[model samples]
Target: MKILGFRGNVDPASYTLSDALPNFGRASGDRSHAHSGSTAKGRDGADVPIAPLVTIAIPTFNRAELVEKCVRSAMAQTYPKLEILVSDNASTDGTVEMLRAIDDDRLRILTSEENIGAIGNFNKCIDEARGDYFVLAADDNYYRPDFVSKCVRLIEDEPGLPIVIAAYDVLVVDEFSKDDRRTVPARLSKKLSTGIWQGTDILQEYLHGRISAQLLSSLVRTDILRRNGGYSPHPCASDEATWIPLLMEGRAGFVDEPCATYMVLRESLTEGFTADKRLGDLREVLDELSAVTAKKVSDPAMRERIQQLLNRYLAYMAAVNLVIYRRGGASLSQAVQKLWGWRTVLAKCSVTDFLSTWRLRSIVRILSPQPLARWMAKNGFDQWV
Candidate 1:
């Protein structure tokens, strides 16, 4: 597989916080209206005031074009005291030049002399943030103009809410035809009422796929995030690692509106993963989460339940990997051999569990000839694999 966009070889010591400090300049707009002592109704019907500052951190790699759109979207936020931070992960794609061209005073550009990988860049964003609330915006994603305003209102209304997970729309740009684009609301399990929820409740919802863990969809409290440690170093599931722990520590607010757009790039890190590699990444994520849960939860029964949940999740992922391998042209025997040897996958379930967890049709597809499986996928009859 091709390397992820931000994982280029570069010395870690080359970039420091001093290199990324922003020069303060007056932004063009009169943001006074944004800070107008606005108050919104809380979950308990009491008036709550908005926080003073909101920071949006965009950690970008090499996507110059997409990064510009992301920055523009962030700059368009209606929130009054907003700061737009662009942490360039030492891009050779003219991303720095593009950011420099933007005249908005609210926009701050931070340059790294060398690539710091995605996780490092993300943590750098957190370290440099100076707002009461923060949003880790992806370079490839764009937000609606009111995204921040709405999220801020939610958090402000629900005092003590550490994070607010908003709904987002998926923007799928056709690989072959860039003009043929489709925008669809992300399919969430259920529409939750706007309110503050317990950390365990949200975690349960996330584990059940009722809520999304997308970093772009979340608005976090800066201090809470720092106390828990920013994003994890795990390449694939850092979002999960960070958000789950933070949610466990405090209450979370929910916003039902689809406020951001996640662009599905063909060559992006997520799409580039092979079935085996994807499964491995999931295993690493589960292991990290399991360790965190075990350390934090004291009840033996709750710990056992979490373990069972982990095993079930692993089973689901293994089944998905089976489908992915088949879609990647792996023969039945090759797929089985590769999956069977994975220790984490094996530990999740026994042979009987694996057989019973997946449906007969799914197994048939996994075992089908490569040509047939490819034809089915091409015809759009099999979309999930």
Candidate 2:
């Protein structure tokens, strides 16, 4: 893995995990910048350390209007110590000017003359973060004031906890500009325990290809992430691909309360089933994950569960790619090619015909292009995806 700065480029693979962590970890303080630690007042200049310092990383690309509110939400956290890092991935919008207007001493900006792409930006933020804990804040999402505090508590107290997933409500905003908001409880399943994301215990829940699997809705231990080499610099579902395996750090934990709001936007990745152009990068990352699991984890049952998870995810990717192609943005041939790629990979990893039948209809619809997909949705198969 290579760690590229806004301008400086450094290769991470050259350094051992021990060396990688402390150098970046020095950035993990309650202080936002090297100078002005004392006068860099938060909201009321009050001081509190109940929560560990969390590096709030917002990776933005032209979404200046919504990004500001997202940054402000991070600033409003009741958790006192926060190091806000805004990574502008070559945004042409007035994001730079907007960031400058904030003028909060606690805020720092990292700019790039070239667009290193989304995953690269995400990796850079993780490599550069200066907090005991880290959050992948969306440019359009709003977090509750207690989000950081609650996450820190879980990470600090839980002995083996690696990542802490938070419960959040999903909001569907009006189609106009970025401001009009319509809120509803994000229909997260009770069966899908937050524990699945916590890394505390193995979740029998299907691991592979579950789109709901995410890192943005969770806060992670920086040390653990660094040890694992941070987020995979991949396309599309790298967050899911990397996070599912990392959850093995401990049983997943949850506050059992909604404290954050995930904004659903048309431009957001979740909005469509389109495969990322960097899907190949994600495939490499998953391949690495399976290799790591075989080496690090010893239990057969756990390994089996992980394999099942990967298999399911691969199938889902194929189905989603079909939808994207149907939507007329990408070519059908490319989607089919990726589907075949996933099938070949998972076949080697042990996805049996029996277990693969779990979502057979959905997979078949992608391959055959039947109207049965609509029928499945009517029959509650949409949730199966």
Candidate 2 residue-wise lDDT, 269-320, digit = tens: 1232234343344456557767766765578877766666555544444344
Error of 1 at 183 (Å): 4.9
Per-residue lDDT for 108-183 in model 1, tens only? 8888887776667777878887776789887877898988888777676665467887767655455234564544
Indicate the TM-score of model 1. Answer: 0.77
Rate residue 59 of model 1 by lDDT.
86
Error of 1 at 197 (Å): 1.3
lDDT value, candidate 2, whole model: 0.55
Each candidate's clash count: 0, 16
Output the number of the TM-score-best candidate. 1
Ten residues in sequence with the least summed lDDT for candidate 2? 5-14
Cα displacement (angstroms), candidate 1, residue 120, comes to 1.6
Candidate 2: where is the Cα deviation over 4 Å? 1-51, 168-211, 255-258, 267-283, 329-385
Quote each prediction's TM-score: 0.77, 0.68
